[model samples]
Target: MQEVLDALEAPPIDPEARIALQRYYVRCEMLRKVDKRYSEDGRSRITLLVRTIIESEGNENALVEPVLVAVNSVLRPGWTGKGLAFIEAFDGFPFVTTLETMRGLNLFKEENLGQYLGMVLHNRLLSLLGPPEALSAEKPKRKPARPLRRAA
Candidate 1:
């Protein structure tokens, strides 16, 4: 609980609280986005009225929609390398130091703050590059094996 809370310090605001607010917003959008495909207003209203569930029934409180929107807007899909540097400053670190498990934080010094931020951002980049699965391109499906020909 604390870890999640602590990891949400988004700077300029209580990051945890902002996430709560964002979830509420997403719930509302899920009911009525511009597209017909996402129009769940009737069902959403009924579910809210009945069981009072405010989030996706079995989902992990997904941030994919927001993340994808941000990533696509800037990263333009298939854009790789350079890593998540653009987001590191707001990634629960900002003006603080991030402990190994992302479980700790400390105020940044006036002078050394930028250096520490660089280190943290660098580590994040390394982490992104280190995972081959993450870096690998989405593979196309393999064609069916060609039929064996008789040795004539």
Candidate 2:
């Protein structure tokens, strides 16, 4: 795990993105340490999800990692996290970070890491897209829904 922590130093990524990534790592650790109540056939849910993420690559029938997809959309669009290391894509475009400072960070205490990561990712997307006013201006007006006809 030290190696994973140390890996954060070489390629700088966004602070928020870094936090999300670390939180994910911490989550994986937590899942690893949790009891077997969550296990099925000797494998925990996290293990299954990680397997899916790895095995699903290039196969249309396999389940994709939705969280990874969202992370890529905000950090580096169209990136598949292929060839590059697990966290390398964060160094591109808008996302970039150090984990040393995480020791004192209170936000990590949240119970739901996934929700927290989503919030961070959303904020990063908003920042990159521009201010809220600009976003509102850019949004196209939606046409009103037409009434549906009764089959009878």
Candidate 3:
């Protein structure tokens, strides 16, 4: 977990690749929500979701809605002013660090502080990308051509 956080905090050599990785994370989360069976199979949910989304002819909006919902659900609690402040300071907070450090002490049988941090990061990335649209509604309409007129 420390390794992952350190890597994330480090400055990126390739900004584009970093952005792509962030998007990939969001996509994986979306896919996991769309299909619960992937979690049961112990396969790579991210890879499966990317492949499925790429190959399917279904509307993009259809695919994005569930992903948005999943991401939204996590952020819903943070909508309040106090929750928002906690979220903003989440990474650097002493309480957060204490919780993470305590995980090594084996207080809980199963600790998921790292997972929660990852989710928060994922939510932040998605928020920056703006809302996902499964289906774009900006198609241009074509006007009928006027009848050809003879030269005067």
| lDDT for each residue of candidate 1 in 49-77, tens digit (9 for 90 to 100) | 21111121322122222221222222211
TM-score of 1: 0.21
lDDT of 2 by residue, 1-152 (tens): 22442332222334553454445556545665684432222123223223323333332222222343344333322222232432332333221121213224655543334344545655654554432232222456899999999999
Ranking by lDDT: 3, 2, 1
lDDT scores in order = 0.35, 0.37, 0.37
What local lDDT does model 1 show for residue 90? 31
* Top TM-score prediction, candidate number: 2
Looking at model 1, report the run of 10 residues with the lowest lDDT sum: 47-56
RMSD of 1: 14.6
Task: Give Cα distance to truth, residue 39, candidate 3, Å.
Answer: 24
Q: Clashing residue pairs, candidate 3?
A: 60-134, 61-134, 61-135
Candidate with better TM-score, 1 vs 2: 2
The TM-score ranking, best first, is 2, 3, 1
Candidate 1 residue spans exceeding 4 A from truth:
1-109, 130-152
